[model samples]
Target: MTDWNGAALEKIAAAEELDLAPERPNGTLRDPVTMWMVRAGHRPYVRSVKGSDGPWYRGTQSR
Candidate 1:
């Protein structure tokens, strides 16, 4: 398993606000889309607003 740095981990844990998005192959970010964030243990996750059918979501899968 991979280990995360304490300070970086804390930053994510302490975040009350987040602007998360998946990167495109061309190195640009997808259109600004809002999604909920959830944490389990020390890991954070974001879900697709358009679910699997979302363009941004699909873009991530292709990479």
Candidate 2:
């Protein structure tokens, strides 16, 4: 697995939003979903404001 460097983490944290395109079971990418992200210490995290019922969140579970 790839690890995040300090610079990359800073860049992502600086952004107000990010786009996530989750892969489907068939290996095709779903539509990009705009999401809010945060840098927690050395790790990055994201969540669906719409909660678990959000379409984007559900799509991620498929992968």
Best by lDDT: 2
Ten-residue stretch with the least lDDT total in model 1: 15-24
lDDT of 1 at 8: 76
Candidate 1 collision pairs: none
What's the lDDT for all of these models?
Answer: 0.69, 0.81
Q: Ten consecutive residues with minimal summed lDDT in candidate 2?
A: 54-63
Tens-place lDDT per residue, model 2, 2-56, is: 5689999998999878888877778998888778898778888888766689998
Best by TM-score: 2
Decoy 2 TM-score against native: 0.74
Give the CA lDDT, 0 to 100, for residue 13 in model 1.
Answer: 62
Backbone-clash count (model 2): 0
User: lDDT tens string, model 1, 1-63?
Assistant: 565577776777675545666666689976676655666776767677678997767777887
Give stretches of model 1 more than 4 Å off: 1-18
**TM-score of model 1 (CA atoms):** 0.60
In angstroms, give how far residue 9 of model 1 lies from its true place: 5.0
